[model samples]
Target: MGFFDRNIFIDIIEWLPENDDLIVYKYDRHDNEIKNGAQLIVRESQVAVIIEQGQFADVFYPGTHTLSTENIPLLSDLRGWKHGFDSPFVTEVYYINTKFITDLGWGTPNEIMLRDADFGIVRISAYGSYHVKVNDPVTFLKEVSGVEDAFTTEMLDEKLMPFVLSNFTDTLGEAKVPALDLAMKYKEIGDECEVLLQTKFDQFGIEIANFIVENISLPESVQEAIDQRASMGAIGNMNTYQQYQMGNAMGNVGEGNSEGGSVNSTINDAMQMGMNMGMASNMINQMMGMQRNAQAPQNQQAPPPVPSGPGAPPPVPGAAPSQLSFHISSNGSQYGPYTLDQLKQYVAEGRVNKDTMVWREGMPAWAPMGTHTETASLFGGMATPPPPPPPM
Candidate 1:
């Protein structure tokens, strides 16, 4: 009631803000004074700061404290108090929440230029959320909270957004994750960002409790390109895809539901078109360094069934077909019915050799070209007869 009355000053001070996101709260001490022996209550995940005039004087952790002239000599000296000559001192009491404030959002406010391997030069943006708390209240108040009585996560988000985006961009760029692989590397990038950002945020007295990367978005054109690539990947082997398309078309033709087979014929034509396209695509891919496995020809007629067992007669060479033309199996593939001359050309081209399997229409079964009479001439007759007797 009276300035000189010691009992009239504020007795105890504590804070419990109503707003959950409130990071800093200044206790209202309207017309009240911080005199000697005042009680200060600081709860868990909370910190109290005593700022005298414009300069910080003291900070209190989670505990009950009794303010005394001896304990707070700085406040007493700053107030110029000597004995009981001076009255209560004017000070600022701030409460900082040390609990993790969740759902604090961050994102790239603008598109960042990126040189992506798959898409070349492209622009990308990213978004994520994080949690934070005041790890160092004194520094936060002096450097960040900055004389503001009430501070909230929204205010903190505005300050940290640019830094978050900067770190995210650098981390993502350094990670060198391809646009096609960004979906798989979200966590990796986020983890790196969290590590890099902690170093920066530590000096500001804020701690990133957890960092997350929800999505790294690409440009619309780049996204469409990715989708197209994914679709192509889904198709797997182009040859197999073409076969599948043809199979579907043939299955439709077998249904016989179309009038005069018009639809069936169209389906067949489309399938053929797809096969041609697939062949061209394979060639282009090969030229572009996308090597594919060489597929065996599926349409080559199988060599006539071999007559097995030792009892089967080894047919006399003279009884073979008169045409001298034969089919040959080379490197696991069946080739044309070539004449002796054509076989010689094949030998010249290195497509046929001594061990090549050859079959003429009249042969009992396919026989090695070197051992078969009709084809043996291609590899130099089995073993030439010795001419030494004439010299002797």
Candidate 2:
């Protein structure tokens, strides 16, 4: 009775948040009886909710309020008391900041398992930050309000982090973003994540202002495998690689002999062999630059004329010869210059569609698969009638 006597009048009931937080419950003498003439102060971007006997009574927004029977009808009804009573009342008031709370971190506690285009099934880890806000304080109070002196963002994060990652798994899988190309699709993934999380957040009276993916990474072993595959693809044909290495070795030896003022017949023979093979213009020039001035007369035959007739660019010396490969345009992306065999595989895999645009060497321009007579053969058995029995 002595402690309650001094708290009858609450002149100030305000919450000054230390940081922009999700929700903070305001304290008014810690559930003590608030006199009828007491003051309730709420600031902008904040909402004050009153709870009487474990039920929400009234809500105040962005203004000063006086505690009185007129505005306490809901409270009076919940408390089963008549209006204009002379006695003071007991209630709980919580202030929830509606402003955006940013820089909250979220991440997958466990590696995300996804199928990649190049690496097949691989595990990856991702981390990001997001901004959130409270949209409905009443619903938040009913669902997640903790009976503490103050409810900080940490508590919200404990509940939200799991929700975010769960939604991330579904959204990322549905987007089908390749792990090798995940970096390029951050914005796309983030946008989709926001949409995917909106419905769930709405249920808790929360709004996700922005969701961002800062980094996505794969396991070291998986990354190494991908790198090796890419290196092989870049090296192309093995025979061409051997020729290129031979030319490079000769070039280095020629430089060494000229520096020592000695003749290397073996080196000269290898250089001549590379030149006779119609090495690329660039490689021929590089090898010739290493030759000594006195040795120029020994190999005086003019360089072979570069073959150029616009059939297809001559196979680069020491490089895979350019082959007739088709470029596929699908889903707003140019897939590749796939060889005939690879194109057959793609068709067999059902990756090509009637509207798929394809172009190959000697074609003036790209045309739909169904429109090109030559490439149309790639899409065989696509609703075409079977040939009549021969001479039946």
* TM values, all candidates: 0.67, 0.61
- So what's the TM-score on candidate 1? 0.67
* lDDT (tens digit, per residue) of candidate 1 on 108-188: 878989897766789988888998888999889878988887998889988988888888888877888787888999878
Q: Which tens-of-lDDT digit does each residue in 113-225 have in candidate 2?
A: 89877667889899999998889988877677655657788988988887899888888898887777888999998988898888888888899967999999899987766
Candidates in order: C-alpha RMSD to true structure: 13.1, 21.2
Worst 10 residues of 2 by lDDT: 295-304
Query: Best by TM-score, which number?
Result: 1
Per-residue lDDT value at 268 in model 1: 52
- Candidate 2, residue 335: the lDDT equals 33
Backbone clashes for every candidate come to 0, 0
The reply for model 2, stretches above 4 Å from the true place, is 1-8, 28-32, 225-241, 251-392
lDDT of 1 at 313: 44
Best by lDDT: 1
How far off is residue 33 in model 1, in Å?
A: 2.0
The whole-model C-alpha lDDT of candidate 1 against the native structure comes to: 0.72
User: After best superposition, candidate 2 residue 379: deviation in angstroms?
Assistant: 56
